[model samples]
Target: MLRRWISTLLLGLAAAALAGCSSTRLVDGQVESFSTLTALPAPATYRIERLPSQQTPAFEPIAALAERALARVGLQRDDAAPRLLVQIGVQASSVPRHGPSAPYAFYGPPWAFGGWYGRPPGVFGGWYGPPPWAFGGWGMGGPTPLYRRAVSLVLRDAQTQAVVYETSAVHENVWVSDPAVYGVLFDAALNGFPAPPHGRRQLRLPLPPPAP
Candidate 1:
């Protein structure tokens, strides 16, 4: 019986490997200056706003999450022009039985011989990208079998309403009747931002060539 079980496990592992290989890509860093950037001119008073959410209790959890996150970076809500304002909102949807769709990578071919050329790689290569993992079963077409869920937190400039920061954390659990879990989700979103001295770090984008 043990031998049979071992054989079955190995087969399952092989099947998963065949279905897809895992890979990660770093998002482009867009922040030019973390230090001066995260620092606001010291607002006259800090204010927290909760965007309307279907979950009535979501706002409180979001507030707690923001408070903790701000404290970590040596910011307090009471300060004035007080330089910054935070908005927190929560979004939940029924476990749709499918995971999120992954976007494709765009790789411009080298301009060799004065022009570009190449066929886009297929899904299996993931050079094209991961196939949409259905929540309950296979691709989007399959029957729902599992749960799909996520939460997001956003930060914006008080004056311009331009988003200066944001973060999201996801989990595959049903979104119902769990206040503790919601708070934790907010914390996870807070983890998405850089703190204090670390905040000064800039996202390094490829610099353009200097004029000839």
Candidate 2:
């Protein structure tokens, strides 16, 4: 029993050590930008188009949030090259934190320590005995959850028919269970893009200093 107790204690300590690594975060920031809105006539009404071939569930909420954001930025929605073309594309998925075949174990007190059978004084006056029934076995344990997501949104110029700017935002430490959060994040990302004038003239968005 005493032996089992020691074993169980060690196992528990190990498990606690592992639990320290577990972490979670909701709605990491987003990324976004637009073409030179200043060059084009101020858009009054605009059209929001769903990106071609995107089937993920995160799309709708992102679309709704983007529409509100564009409206706030003074661009209207239009489909037939009226002014600006707003398009939304998204991808969401999870990757396991642990390897596929990770091992798991059970832990409990030793049978002799306080478990099933206690060691009464042995023949030579030594204490020895089998573990108690209450003592548990190893190899029995529960599973844990790990989830993550990668999402992207893009804005283009309708008349020029070119991607004025595109943004790819990642929410690393989240389960992405709620779509509303995606929309909220989309709004926040839209705010991150500065006014068109601040964008890169050729590629737009502050040019990264020449790659070292």
Candidate 3:
């Protein structure tokens, strides 16, 4: 019985650890510019611009990744006279979540002689005995903070100054740092490009394998 209880506790801890590591990436957005257009527009050239606050060296690599995604969708980098301008922005935040509650509560009688398990016969209850499983609240703890990373991409007609397309992707995890997260975000942001699903939709994309 003791060994079985220990095994069950270990399994619960393992399952909780796996759950903490698992993350979900949510991709959803609206396309304000695709309504008037009949077919996906092929711009001659496009230029990527970072948000005023995001103009920093750290964002350079991220911008390059966004550019690559655009290129895949038939847009070439151009400094001057580009038909479309791409604006990329990134936002990250920490969300606090309450940890799992204790699994078992101890309440029972006090032990006396003859290995008495429960409380004695009395009006008020005796001391509560610990659960059969020695390690009942092993993993339960304080609030855990989770990190969320989001990326937004917007495309505008250079001449008309009208918003053509836009999309955003958000990911939640215990710790969000992998560069592949942004890559996947951009991919999901531009999934349908000029045309996307009308209503909000959930997108699940597999993350790249960890480097050896």
Q: Report the number of the highest-TM-score candidate.
A: 3
Q: Considering every candidate listed, which one attains the maximal lDDT?
A: 3
Give candidate 3 regions above 4 Å deviation: 1-37, 99-139
lDDT of 1 by residue, 12-36 (tens): 8677666633332122221211222
Scored by Cα lDDT, where does model 1 land? 0.40
lDDT comparing candidate 3 with the true structure:
0.57
Per-residue accuracy of model 2 over 2-82 as CA lDDT, tens digit each:
999999998986676466324222345435345444443455555666534333342444556567766665666666645
Candidate 1 lDDT score at position 56: 42
Give lDDT per model, in order. 0.40, 0.43, 0.57
lDDT for 46 in candidate 1 is 49
Backbone clashes in model 3, listed as residue pairs:
107-128, 108-127, 108-128, 109-119
Across residues 68-143, which tens digit of lDDT does each residue of candidate 3 receive? 7777766788978688878886554443445544232222211101112332322122212221122332334433
- List candidate 1 segments past 4 Å from native: 1-45, 52-58, 79-81, 96-149, 174-177, 195-212
